[model samples]
Target: MSLLLLVDDPARPDVVGLRSLSDDGTLLDSSEVPTDALPAVARERADRPRWVWDDTARRYPPLLAAGVRVERCHDLRLCHAILRRSVYTQSSALAQAPPGPWDGPRDPAPVEGSLFDDVGPAAVADPLEELQLQLAAVAGSDEPGRLRLLLAAESTGALIAAEMHHGGMPWSVETHDALLTDLLGPRRKGGRPAKLEALADEVRTALGQPALNLDSQPDLLRGLRSAGCDVESTRTWEIKALEHPVRDPLLAYKKLSRLLSANGWAWMEAWVHDGRFRPEYVPGGVVTGRWATSGGGALQLPASIRGAVRADPGWKLVVADAAQLEPRVLAAMSGDGAMAAAGRQADLYQGVVDAGIVETRSEAKYAMLGAIYGATTGPSAVLMPRLTTAYPRAVALVEAAARAGERGDVVSTWLGRTSPRPDAAWQAELAAASAEGAGADDVRAARRRGRDWGRFTRNFVVQGTAAEWALCWMAALRRRLLAVDGRPHLVFFLHDEVMVHSPAAVAESVAVAVHESAVEAGRLLFGETPVDFALDVVVADSYDQAK
Candidate 1:
C-alpha cells in the first residue's frame, strides 16, 4: 500500500489532503490532516507506504522537523523532468499532453518561518494529473524497467538530500580556525591573511615592482612582462613554465589567495553553525543528474581544510570513494569485456597496464580519457589508435555518440537521461553555414560548434551515466544504513565519494555497507557485468585521516 499525499498550498501549512493509493494508482482511501499532525500520520505508516508528493525537499523537511521519517516517496517534479526529455518516452501520448504549470521548475525552497505565516504553498498545482501522465509515460516506454530504476534512484536522492540537511555535516570550527591560523597566521581586519600579504610582498619584490597590485590579473600580467618574463596570463600553469624570481612566489600567492577567498573566516561564519556545516544541496540540478550545491562549497571541499571535518565525540567518520568510477561505467555501459577485465583489479589504470593495453599507467589513463572525451590531438590523440584497437566496443560507443552530437542529434545514457537537443540559435547558425553559397569563415565557425558539441556529448554519455551510478550507490547506502542499529548516516557526498558518520562501534559495519552499496549500485545499473566499481573505504576520527 502507498499514500498519495496531495499537499495543499504551503502558505496554509496546516492543511493537507491525503489519499491512500494502491500499487496500481487506484484510490483506496482519502483523508485530511493539519500539517502539524501529518507527522503523526507519517509515523503511523513509517517505512510501509511510499509517500507520493509534489516535491520531497519541500514536504519532507517539515516531517523531519517533527521527528518523523518516511520510508519512500515518489517525487512528481523530478519524474516529470526525466519523462519529458527521455528518448524512451518521446513518442508516448503522455509526452504529447499540453504543457501546464507543472512543466516549469518548482519555486525555490521556502525560508524559515512559522508554519502559520501563510506564505502560500509551493505545491504543484496538479500533482494527481502529473502522476498519471508520468505513469503512462513509463508504462509506454520501451525500457520501462530502466526508467523505473532511474526514477527510483532519483527520488531516493531527494530523500537523502533532505535528511542530510536536517542532520548537517559535523564540523569543528576550532579545528578549521587552528588550521587556518597555522597556515595563514591569525585573522586580520578587512584585509588578506598575514602569510598571503607576505607572499604578495615577495611577488612584488621578485617582479621589482614596489606597488603593483598582485590581486589584479592585468596588473600582475603587466608586472610579469615588465620584469622580463614572457607571459600571456597570470594563471599558475602559464607562470609555472617561466624560470623567473616571481614564479614560485606568484604560484604560492595564487594558492593562498584561493584558500582565503573560498574558505576564509567569512565563509566560516556563514556556512557553519552549532559545530556543523549545512550546505543546501540541489538534487538533479545538473543536466546530467549530478547534485549541485547552492552554498557552503560542499562539492569543492579542499584537502587543506578537510581537517575541520571531525566526527562527534564517540563517533567515527567512514569515508569511501570509488577508485575508477567513470571508466568502469564506460566499460559496463558499452559491454567492453576487455575494459571490464581491466577494471576487475583494484587500480583500473594499473590493471590496464598489466593487460598490456598501454606501456605505462599514465598512457592508459590518457588514452581512455581521450576516447571518452573525444580528444583528437596531442598525446591523447597520439594514444587513440591503441585504445581503439584494445577496447573497440568502449571506444566505438563514445565515437558514435560524438558523431551524433556533431550532427545535432540527441544521445541518452544507459538509463535514458537524454542529452538536450541543440538550441535554436545554434541550429540556425548550422543551417546558414550549410545553405547555398556560404562563406569559409561561416563554415569554419559551424564546424567548430559541431566539434564542440561533439566533445560535450562524447563525455556526456559516460559522465551522465556515472552520475546515475552514484545516485544508485548513495540511495542503496541510505537504506542499508537505516537498517543498522546505531546512529550511522551519510553526512557528505561528492560525486564518487561519500562520508558516513557513525558510532565508533559500528564504523566497521558502516564500511561494509559502503562496499556492498557499491556492488549493489553496479548490479542495479549494469545488471551482472564483469566491470568492478572498487571503493577505498577508510574509517577514521577525522576527515583528513581518511586519506
Candidate 2:
C-alpha cells in the first residue's frame, strides 16, 4: 500500500490530503489533515505507507524537520522526467502525451522561512492520475524491471538527499578557520586575506604596473601583454608556459584568489551552521543522472580544505570510494570477459600494464580514458589502437554510441536514461556540411562539431550507467546501515565516494557494510557479470586519511 500526498501550495498548506491506494490502484482510504498535524498522522502508522508526492524537495524537508522520517516515497516529478524522455518507455501514452505542469521545473523557488509559516489552501485532489501514468509507463517499458529499478533508485536518492541534509555533514569550524588562516593568512575585515594581498603585490611588481588590479581579467591581460609576455588568456596553464617574471606570481595569485572567492571566510559563515555543512544536493540534476549541488559547492570540495572534515568525539568517519568505477562499468556493460578479468585486480590500470598492453599505468589510464572520452590526437590517440585491440568489446560499445551520435541519434543508458537529440542549429550545420557546395573548412568545422557531441554521447552511456550503479550502491549501504546498531548515517557523498559517521565501536560494521554493499550494487546492476567494483574503504578520524 502507498499513500499519495498532494500539495496545493509549496510555501504553506492549509490542508494536507492523503489517499491510501492498493497496488492494483484501488483507493482504500482518503482523508485530510491540517499542516501542523500531518507529521503526527504519518508517524501514527507502524508500517508506514510509501508516501507518493509530486516533489520530494518541497515536502520531505518539513517532515524531516519535524522529526519524522519516511522510509519510502514515489517522487512523481523525477519519474515523470524519466518516463517522458526515456526511449525504452516512449511507447506508453504518458511518454507520448504533450508536456504539462508536470514537465515544468521540478523545484520551485525555495521556501524562505519557517516550514509551515505560510498557511495556504488544501490540495484539490490526490495526484494518483500522475502516479498511475508513471506506473503504467514503467510496467510497459522494454525493460520494465530495469526501468522500475531506475525510478526506485532515483526516488530513494531524493529521500537520502533530504535525510542527509537533515543530518548535515560533520564539519569542524575551528579546523576550517585554522586551515584558512594558515593558507591565506589572517582574515581581514572587509579586505583581502594577507597572503592573497601579498601575492597581488608580487603580481603587480612583476608586471611593472603598481596600479594593476588582478581582479579584472582585461586589466590583467593588458598588464601581461605590456610586460613583454605574449599571452592570449589568463588561464593557469597558459600562464605557466609563458617566460615572464609575472608568470609565477600571477599563477599563485590566481590560485589563492579562487580559494578566497569560493570557500573563504564568507563562504564558511553563509554555509556552515551548527558545525555542519548542509549542502543542497539535487539528485538527477545532471543529464547523465548524476547528482549536483545547488549550494555549498558540495560536488567541488577542494582537497586543500578537506582536512576540516572531522568526526565527532565518540564517532569515526567511514570513508569509501569506488575504485575505477567508470572503466569497470564499461567492462560489465559491454560484457567483455577479458576486460572484466582485468577489473578483477585491485588496480585495473596496473592490470592492463601487466597484460603488456601498455608500458606504464599512466599510459593504461590515458588509453582507457581516451577511448571513453574520444581522444582524436595526442598520447591518448596514439595508444588507442592497442587499447581497442586489448578490449575490443568495451571499445566497440563506445564507438557504436559515438556513431549513433554522429547520425543525431539518441542513446540510452543501461537503465534507460536517453541522450537528448541534437538541436535545430546542429542539424542545420550537419546538413550544410553534407551539402554539395560545402567548403573544406566548413566540412572540417562540421566534423569537429559532430565529434564533440559524439564524445558527449560516447561518455554519456557509460557515465550515466555508472551513476545508476552509484545510486544503487548508496541505496544498499543506506538500508544496511539503518538496520545496524550505533546510528551509522551517511554524512557526505560525492560522485563515487561516501562518508558514514558512525560510533567508533560500529565503524567496523560500517566498513563491512560498505564492502558488502558494493558487491550488492554490482549484482543489482549487472547480474553475474564477471566484474568486481572494488572499493578503497578506510575507517578514519578524518576524510583525508582515506584518500
TM-score of each: 0.94, 0.95
Candidate 2 lDDT, tens digit per residue, 1-547?
5555554554446787777787655677878789888888778877667888988998899888888888888888788888888999889998787656676564453323211122324433236788888878887788998998899899999999988888998899999999899989999999888998999999889888999988999999999999988889889999999988888888888988898889989999999999899999888888888887778898888888988889999999999989999999999999998888888998999989988999999999999999989999999999999999999999999999999898888998999988888889998999999999999998998888898899999999999999999999999999999888989999888889999999999999999999999999999989988899999999988877777
Worst 10 residues of 1 by lDDT: 110-119
Please give the clash total of every predicted structure, in order: 4, 1
Which residue pairs clash in candidate 2? 14-120
- Which TM-score value belongs to model 1? 0.94
* Cand. 1 Cα-lDDT: 0.86
Q: What is the Cα-based lDDT of residue 197 in candidate 2?
A: 94
Query: What would the per-residue lDDT of candidate 1 be over residues 128-234, giving only the tens digit for each residue?
Result: 66677788899889899999999988899989998898899999999999989888888999888799899999999998899999888888889999999988887
In candidate 2, what residue range of length 10 has the lowest lDDT sum?
111-120
